[model samples]
Target: MGAQGCREDGRPETVLEGWFVLLLDLEAFAPRERVDAFHHAMTDSSVPNEIVHEECDAGMSARIEGWRVGALDLFDMRCSGLEVRRTARHVRQHRDRPVVSVSLQTQGIHRAEQAGTRSTLGPEDICVFHELAPRTYGWSGHGASQAVTVDMEHLGLPVDTVVRASGRLRASPVHDLLLGHLRSLFRDPGRLEADPGAGALANATTDLVRALLTSAAHDERDGRVREAMGSSLVPRIMAYARRHLTDPDLGPERIAAEHAVSKRQLYVVLGRAGIRLEQWLIGERLEAACRLLVSPHHAALPVSAVAARCGFSSPSHFTRRFRAAYGTTPSEWRRHRIRSIC
Candidate 1:
């Protein structure tokens, strides 16, 4: 089938390569019930389902809830699945692709092992792993639990970078961000299409994955330095730009002033990252305008209104820039997007 073929289940057979998302809900089921539901979902979805009842035993229990979001390259053909078991079992063979699984427990304790290292994950705590490698996971039914699987390729992260940042297992705030975004995506796919900042949302997911992997593979001292001086700055700048996207005066001078950094220093920071500050700001504003242009909430608003909301003062200028960035004029893009959604 072609990459765009749609399945009967409403999921496209082959999602676009850049990024795709999945959201699952398990609030209706308890811990054991949730695992059972997962087992059924896997088997029903054509995933491997070699259930070994002997491996089932009481471990730690907890409640699980949240979202998982990341970029995906559909052409990669790397498969991943989520499963829960009470006891850790040794497996001889695993998938060939790297896999990172993150989980949150409301009631129990969970332990995962890889490369001779073991880590226990507690309630609200997360665990990550490479599925292609050998590993063992054990948990007790102390309460309900939830987990998600991310194929390394879909994560839009470099394997060596991730290994260096986190290695086989580690935890960070990025994991929580990923989970939360995933949950939100699942809860309302429409919001993704309607969100004025959808592009940023997508970019954030990919960026977070990259950051997590980089942190894992690097040394602790270096990682701390990067996090303190380098890592946090980008997001702050991004947030500042997004908030004032519609302000005509929201240029580098104002941005630098707000952050208490010299314009030269701000430029240096962005330049070192190989991105032009002005171009980045323009791209962000255009993306926000695109969202409003297509959003049902603001669909009744005039095209010029949308452009103005995104800081575009001249209609012609906005049209030119929007077309240059997205390859479609604002009106055409909105029409096409609306048709797709309907």
Candidate 2:
């Protein structure tokens, strides 16, 4: 939420957490038609699975809404008595992006089976499972859950650490914190996603999940977890800075303030990662300007406009730096790129 307000470049506000794109209301479908439609939606949704429930009763219904938040996908799901299976076959058939699924049970009973372990979760209970592994999950009656799927690599933990933590999340001190966050997120998904700082919020959520896993696995002795935890700040800072690159005032003081660090501390973190803060910022700004110069949509804009959009306040200064970096002026670079494409 510390991110800058509205952009001045006139681009539409960036929606960090994308709008929910998958919406299904199966209650209106005929009893016989509901299962197939639900099955199709299940297969097509962000997480692919095989719908195995055999009954097609009149009361059966399912509604799922999914939102994308950076490296995470969140689903608000409600259904009446159904099972979904994700076998090794399903794993192979779908895209091979390994992820971990965290589910917060809010209504009815949710049953999950994975790695020879079966768990029955009631309201306010949480469960975690690896998406690439063979698993079966569903409920026997009407149930609702808020599920978040995050790319495994983003956790910065080894596979064994995650596997160990998955079945024992409550052992972690931060489990309730993560649970409460998911609850609040799903309460008004659209409104929250629309917030300007939703991207940073999502990143914070991912960090909390990582911390929870590290604590649950009792991985303080494990150097991988310890090192990952220690070294995460650099990436976090870089991401924050990149998001604000369009702001001319995105300097050390502003960045340090947003991250709750002193300007000196910010420099120390990036310095440890071999980054020269001023040069890095300039490089990123130049790179952004280069992309805009060659982009078809921005081609009509003058070189000065392109420089201004990328945070440069002086057109002549932008040209000099652009030429120094790319061996040509911005206008020349854009013309060359257009000619090459044609």
TM-score of each: 0.44, 0.59
For every model shown, the clashing-pair count is 34, 0
Q: After superposition, how far is residue 77 of candidate 1 from its true place, in Å?
A: 18
Give the alpha carbon lDDT tens digit for every residue of 175-271 in model 1: 4444454443444434454557655555554555555555556554675536533554565566556667789889999989976789999988878
| Whole-model Cα lDDT of every candidate shown, in order | 0.54, 0.73
Model 2 agreement with the true structure over 8-47: per-residue lDDT tens digits: 5321122233455545666545666667667656655546
Q: RMSD to native for every prediction?
A: 10.0, 13.8
Worst 10 residues of 1 by lDDT: 72-81
What is the TM-score (0 to 1) of candidate 2? Answer: 0.59
On the 0 to 100 scale, the lDDT of residue 244 in model 1 is 72
